[model samples]
Target: MPAASASSARSNSALSGSRCHDRLRTFHERLQSGWRMSAPLELFSYWRSSAAYRVRIGLNIKALAYVTHPVHLVRDGGEQHAAAYAQLNPQQLVPTLRHGAVVVPQSLAILEYLEEAFPDSARLLPAAPFERARVRALAQAIACDVHPLNNLRVMQLLEREWQRDAAQRLHWTQHWMQQGFAALELQLANALHTASFCHGDTPGLADCVLIPQLYNARRFEVDLAPYPTLQRIEQACLALPAFDAARPEMQIDAVV
Candidate 1:
């Protein structure tokens, strides 16, 4: 093929990609408008679960109204294990989102869903591909590497299955939390992406994930002084009403 022909084809490909993005954005705008005209969304959540806390931030950031159906993870042998809630989420996890007939499970997936389903909401992802990837990598570094190993089930296993005492269990949690935060601190301490929040001036996915983990860190009595970058970011996030309102202590069913 001629060089001129190849150039023309490339131009056409770029145009096609731009058009597709515009159409998708238009669809999302319509969805957001429709949601505003409807009732509040329903979320199955446990106030103390970090994953659930993350979802609450996303919902508030989107400016989407939602009513929480408290799924006590501990009371009455864990309400999430009941037959009714299991039908919505077979995994028996907190933070399951219900919008109309569409049910979404998984915290990260639900965040992405809100972004796509309600583009008018606060932008959870940057328009640039590389920036979005970076933000996701930062968020996953905590959500996957840190939070999972330190969750309630893990603590329960340490007590019931392993017979580890409270002091030993606290040590176990502090170990993994420190390991994860040390690497994250290095990543954010001086990077260009570091700002008031996780990505840029606006709070997005990384902020959503990080704030919850910080809450967890304090809960386990992990010494946070070592990670100034994380602590600074958490302070910035908590200053915002959307994030402050989503905190575990602010929930209707928060335990004493």
Candidate 2:
């Protein structure tokens, strides 16, 4: 190789390394400064969506500022099905989170990401491994085992494909919620770890997941008298400013 070419190659490599170093430094500075990025976080949400509701609570608890891009689920046969939004989230689900170049779908994943990305901020998981697993089990019980059965898409499918009426839909939602809440009530009522919230005194992942499902249960007129423990925790959570502010009615896109 020519002497001049080798020198040019060395200079280019040095410049690339310097650029990478600068990028990392900037990112570190942003993380240390409470994630106050120039781009800001963006959330694709539907106001009444339980999944979106959970993410809102997590964001509020973390005290993170974010921009809400409302995706109306009903109007014009569901705006989430539109090409542009579909490209952002192939699942066409509400509560897709965009953080700069990183786009995260699913509410639980978003909550976990926030906990990891901003460790200096409020934590959504406990420090103990066993406690963390307990919290996650409770969260998944609602988010995975229960909420999916009663979400809008499932209701739509029942109506459109199975020709189920509103009364039938209500029964469907109520049955699943009752089963889930019954189990949750038993766990919380017996567990020594349960405190003011699901896992401890502070509201964490389980609380964030639980409150939204309770809201849905109320919306569908499910009987809550059986789950006194859940109701008590719900009251404790709603009294907090973070959970209060994240209510579906308080959202900017809420309908009357």
Candidate 3:
């Protein structure tokens, strides 16, 4: 077996193990805890959205129980605009987490809320404040810089309003991804703070955002040969169960 194949197999196995454990945890919470009514969490999501994917990773990392409600983004002129979906999320974004009455919007805000609400869970940010800031910086580098410009809605706008052809769209995606990856490569290469994962031995916010952006980059056929450090970190992150489970391809609503 080739190395990549072996690696992919191991990742799939780990993902299966994580999901099995999640189900068991969920079962114990419901059956053993005597909750007959409602689940603790409700995650409004679209499977392919990377923003939602980030929140999913955070949920998995904390081992929190949350049921996903898929919202189709492209069907019927975008279901996100429907009155029902709009009521849940005024911003019309996919990842709207309902923790009791509190509706959390934005992936980063959701992650922060999870960290605060469940402080006992594995720390997503480091102990030191500066270290935590560094992690946030790395995460935002991809989330803000790379993803927004290449989002489906944005691409559609470029096509309709700006009259961009398919070739132009590809150029735009590659252009932004290359810029983000190039800067990220330099940051990761020089910073000794980076380790097996984005921050240290364990995966953090940076790893979560990085993996999704890399997925998009590949989808756009962006040459990753220029960003070896980013690739190495992605490989390291995906080897772990939390990151593997959050992969776009593994989502329940994934096309393939």
Model 1 lDDT tens row, 128-239 = 9999999999999999999999998889999999899999999999999999999999999989988988888999999999999999999899999999999999988899
Better of 1 and 3 by TM-score: 1
Clash pairs for candidate 3: none
Q: Could you say which candidate leads in lDDT? A: 2
What RMSD value applies to candidate 2?
5.7
lDDT values for all models: 0.91, 0.94, 0.87
Instruction: List CA RMSD, all candidates.
Output: 6.0, 5.7, 17.2
Q: Candidate 3's residue-wise lDDT over 25-119, tens digit each?
A: 99887673343234487888888898998898888888888888888899899888999879988999788998776788899889988887777
Tell me model 3's lDDT, rounded to 2 decimals.
0.87
Q: After aligning candidate 1 to the native by TM-score, how far in Å is the CA of 43 from where it should be?
A: 0.9
Worst 10 residues of 2 by lDDT: 30-39
Model 1 residue 165 distance off true place after TM-score fit, in angstroms:
1.1
Q: Give candidate 3 misplaced runs (Cα > 4 Å).
A: 1-39
TM-score of each: 0.86, 0.87, 0.84
Model 2 local distance difference test score: 0.94
Residue 9 of model 1, lDDT score = 99
Question: How much is 169 displaced in model 2, in angstroms?
Answer: 1.2
Encode model 2's per-residue lDDT on 153-226: one tens digit a residue: 99999999999999999999999999999999999996899989998899999999999999999999999999
